[model samples]
Target: MYLVKIIKLALVSGAIFIGVHAFAQDDNNKAVVMGNFQLDGQYYLEDSAISAVVPEETMALSGFGNILYRKGKFTAGMRFETYLPAPVGYPAGASWSGTGIGYRFAQYSDDLFDITVGNFYEQFGNGMIMRTWEDRGLGVDYMLDGVRLKVRPSDWSEITAIYGKQRFNFDNGTQFVSDDLGQGIVRGINADFDLNSLLDSIVALPGQLSIGGSFVSKFQNNNSARYDFPENVGAGSARLKYNIGGFQFSGEYTWIGENPSAQNAQIVNIPDSLDPSVGLWATGKGVNLNGTYSTRGFGVSITASSLSNMAFQSQREAGAFDSWINYLPPTSVLQTYLLSQLYPYATQPNGEVAYRGDLFYNFKRNTTLGGRYGMKLELSYTQVNSPNIAELNDLGTSRNGAKIDLFDPGDEIYFSDFNAKLTKKFSKKFKGILFYQNIVYNNDVILGAYDYDNVPTKGTVYSDLFVFEGNVKINKKNNIRFEAQALFTNQHLQDWVAGLVEYTVSPHWFFTVIDQWNYGNGDGDDFHFPSVSWGYIKNSSRISVTYGRQRAGVFCVGGICRVVPASNGLSISITSSF
Candidate 1:
């Protein structure tokens, strides 16, 4: 009822504007219009064996369309979203199952200033202090619903400010208030400066230098009486970057004020007793550093970070990816292979130190190591550990959390992984990649309660994963690919093996089938998870239908994660843009 009117209005205005300007003699009368849409629907079937059942609703649909209009310095866009009985395990609760104008924004800009109202998304340097963005795949659409302003005062300086409310997601579809606009009102300011552009004569070098800073604060009324939490939580971050030809380095440091809520309990469990006033939310701080070097076919990067009580959420009681005020950059490798992602690491925001290093090189052709074609090698290693923690005793009335040394090594470890890959092309139509990985995963911390009862040792999981991918082009119009993956472990879930085969016909259609088997679970309850998908593509439009048994696993982004439930169903998706 509401978004329909806006759509009609937009269509009418677009038609009028185009009719009056497209034929105008003026060269600037180039009215621009573009739109994109996506539809995802699923038909749930009851299969007690795989735990896939939809009692109340047999099917579900989720779709959205974004229409944008731009004419010279003026721009406007609107997003329409609808969800009918949202899919299972889609963290965003059921209250979002209605058609509405999810996002709308209009902006006018020139050489000096840009302004937007209604809705927008923005991020500060490295997104350490504040970032308002969206990830449809993760059900994270926390875009800001307010006004944003940006200005370039000089050639070397830029400033941005925003006052908005986050997009609140109902934890589930059934019971939630219509607080779709978010629960907290947040305000933030960010600025960046380039020293080289401001003063070139003083530092006349072949490199570049830049610095940026951000300050963000979110205000939400506190209702808890047990703990006196701050209604206004403020976080600030500063970042610096410099590059000289082949070498580059960047870092960001952030400080956050104290605020306690659900994840960071007001009462914490220590050695023997519970400290009511001490939790992970007691005045936190974090720092992230990264360095990179590249030469010819050789490139490498190293990233390190320390997080101490750095969990910042708009609503202290929110769960999953809801009402997030700020994001913490993760230091783990984003695995692409199937087996590598089986026990992927998620960032620990409370107190942890993490680091990752990666190197890539391509050997020259006709060499001893390289055959007719060159061979490519990639190596990556990542590790994360708990921060050094010690008690802090102030006045009897003023009890805070423990003090954490950012760089000091702690005894407890969260996760660690080391992986390497080698890729080579034998001929014009064939290529393959071989990979190996070793991972030390702490299921206690990552899987939380889901794995606590499942793990027998109540300890860490030592596992190894191997993967091989080969692809071939069977002519100008046909292509084929295959994948073989295996994971070996002595802990929970034990060993798993997976295989995939895919065939694609150029410019149109593709089919794929994959099967994953948990063959060494120690328990005789081994299972098989298989799926098949067919996809078609035409221009900017594409559609795919998949019928499969989905395995339950932890999906993560940055340092945050959401659990996907196991189900067996038919899913269809279509996307188009014009």
Candidate 2:
């Protein structure tokens, strides 16, 4: 049955692409078709040691395909997706089952104007005010389903406008509905100017400079029973970028009108009379700044941001990454190693101040301290904290209402990390890397834990991690890589050690073996997580398989995160583009 469904989807998608050729009106402007496909399936098994839960169906699968057509200045595309009760850790579940068209769009573009109707993704200046995008790996697809228009007045200036509804979910009800996307309608407009280009046309200018501004608003019906909800909410942002030689600086400030919703709601002490006048209502604001300088083999960068009640969403009641109208940019490094990802950070939108800094230097080759093949060193530090806010004292129970200062960094630290990496090529065929990291994680805030009395149940956890990795080219056709990692901590799950070995055969196949050991648990109990995987790649297509015991942890991509449950499963993945 699964195989039949897969083949059926492929055929349907192919037919859709092939049928587009009939729309080619001119022989000289024939249509060009392109697309890509991916499938991930997993079979679950019961594992008592790790408390792995087996799905009722024992297996799950999800897949998607996008087909695009282009001819002259006209373009169109459609994406079909299916989730057969997605895997255990996937964001989709029974609610997203079955198959249907997830996205479809038609666009026309020329030198001065561009327009798109149906579904599209867009962003405005650092995405502080508006951003519609997708990260399939994270199951985050917030494409707007409506109309978008772009007008370029000149080479140095442009304006954009959009009216749409953010895609929320694929509800395969009796009618197979995917539209009427969210509870609210979103509308936005933006204008951008290139100062350097505009001035250079009249007179020469140094370096480059650009400025942009955006305004986004959402409207929803006021049908609340108890609280007097605001029917319309608006947000705006201004941003600028300047570059001179090896130095660059960029910044943005965003502000939003009162928007009371579940994600950022706070209780207020009001009259006992059942009146709809008082409820969770508050405005929001955000600020982001960055500066960088680089020259030769050295580079340095610093970034800082502050957010207060910035959980902007279309649906007032939506939660957990749903109906988001804006995104808080990430400020931390992306960790790829298995254990390093166990404690990944997720951006806090409620109220926080974050900072990140990076320094990189490359040592010259064939010098006294540079060695034979040169060396590269990278250092990074990131920290996040609660915003400095004055209390309103309206809650009575405690000071709940907040008066935030966007520039002040608070005393309560949420998370901090310092990491360094040194890489070198000792020989023509060998390369090695040494990495170290120290993290201070506030579990009470980041991981979230509270007792029945609303008291904190977890404290801060400090950990030190070390990793060493090496790659060796055995010959022109064979290569080997290995990694050894260790983590020491006194809190949470205690200490861990892990190792990985991978072998690659030229052009086609690869195999991997990995294991993580919880050898220093505070309870004196030991556990082992082992996994094996293999893959084959050819051209643009690849297939991989794995059988493994996965530890429960947060999986993150660019600071956005989702919980992945513990599991023992056999998984298969296939991807191809054409």
Candidate 3:
């Protein structure tokens, strides 16, 4: 029986870690147990395309360790992890090897009131709707396993409550029913206020204001009632923030319920028996979606900012990572390196909506066009859709219309980006930057049309990039930095060229070199990726080494993406802290 349920869950997690370390050593007041610890390990040096899809390439290791404790006001923690043969894109049914004690908690607070139980991580307000957090190299975790409460009843009110069960990967054993086995619950509550002290007693206002609201619910149990689902799945949110001084503004709105996702299913091909009369067609048994969305923000003064319709997720697989949610109110604009790689978009927990904005300005130190200078400009936009379906027909005649195509629904993923930059300082060993970028991509909804190794063309994709970055200072320990990029795509892989160089010898050591060239692909072997690295940082400990040629795309973290295969050599990393 699975080794007696793993030895009774390791004897109930070692008697709850020895009864919370013997009640913190019988409370003996000598308080001061701060905490800090870290360890990271990696080693790999064998490649047959990563050992023929990781059939075991001689060496692989993963580790995590944490132990925190604070005295007065009480606080406790635990985290320990190990993955003997876990690497090469991790998650392949996980559990390559295991070790327990993955986050245990206890907390208490003063100055008002607060409490927490087993595991906890929470977020409301601009979290768009809800959030639960944890991010382990993007493996992502939705930590929530019970009690939590908070209260503050004075200087502007505060309240919260939560109850739960969520944390899926890591051994995959507690889904707590519901697949029709009944018993599945999740609940939440929230409040925050200080609406500028009720709008300054109903009058004078120039800034400062806050308001919040939240309510979340989920309970599962269904006998598949001919498909009516929604055994309670609720959502509600409202928030507003305003400030005046360097400017700031915020907004939020959310609603959810009708849940029924699996991308809304729409598979049909039934006929093992049951035949009505050869003219019997009745497809569309899934997809009944609707989950409202709204997010807004505005800013000025220190430049400008604007945002709208931010999408958020608490589970339903919470985008896999990009970093633990709790809220991710920024819709687009993350862009970094490689033609702004597409990333963790996975939150469609049943529906979606999105929006984003940004702006910054600084220039007025030396004249002649601020030539001692600085300049920056940015723009972003995003859109997503697929909800609201119900259209079935066949026998009763409706012209063969059979809705519910949700899975991959009405396709339309969006993106738009613009950037401009210029910075210069000629003294202190020179410094420079000049950048330009323009991007628009849809690419059949961000790749995944089987990643087009089978060519068809035009699903919307455009790119333009130009960059020149530099830094040089030969004194005080030596330094050098440089980068150049140029990419202009025509469709898929039509143009790309990149370069980087780095050298730093400060408190420790550093060295790096990189190259990427795809130079218009008509299949002339235009793909080449190169890399080299060396690092050693003392004072807390750090180590790094690399030799490479890696390229295989798709490695999203947070919308959960994985599909990396293409390797070519030595790598090592070690980190330590105490």
What lDDT would each prediction earn against the true structure? 0.79, 0.81, 0.56
Residue 311's C-alpha lDDT in candidate 1? 77
Which regions of candidate 2 are displaced past 4 Å?
A: 1-28, 92-94, 173-182, 267-280, 395-400, 448-457, 522-526
Every candidate's CA RMSD: 5.2, 6.8, 27.8
> Model 3 Cα displacement at 513 (Å)?
13
Model 2 agreement with the true structure over 292-367: per-residue lDDT tens digits: 9999999999999888888888877666567788987557787677678766667877788999999999999997
Using alpha carbons, what is the TM-score of model 3? 0.28
RMSD of 1: 5.2
TM-score of each: 0.90, 0.90, 0.28
Tens digits of per-residue lDDT for model 3, 362-387? 55546665566443333334444443
Global local distance difference test of model 2 = 0.81
Could you tell me the lDDT of residue 150 within candidate 2?
Answer: 100
| Cα deviation of 213, candidate 2, in Å | 0.4
lDDT of 3 at 418: 61
What's the count of clashing pairs in each model shown? 5, 0, 12
**Which stretches of candidate 3 lie above 4 Å from their native place?**
1-67, 70-132, 135-145, 148-217, 220-229, 233-337, 340-458, 462-485, 491-499, 506-556, 560-578
Tens digits of lDDT, candidate 1, 1-578: 87999999999999987766764545674668899999999987766554554637788888888999977788899987777866776774424566777778999888899999988889899787788777765566767878899999989999999998777753222121123323578899999999898887676656899999999998877554555668898999999999999999999999889867555653342222345455534777889999999999999999889988777777766665666677875677788776666676777777888888999999999998888899999999999988887876656555556787687769888888899999999999999999999999887777631321222246788999989999998999999999999989887777889999999998999999999887785543536788999999999999999998877666777667766666788999999999
TM-score for predicted model 1 compared with the true structure: 0.90
Q: Which stretches of candidate 1 lie over 4 Å from their true place?
A: 1-29, 53-55, 92-94, 170-183, 201-203, 224-227, 267-281, 393-400, 448-457, 522-526
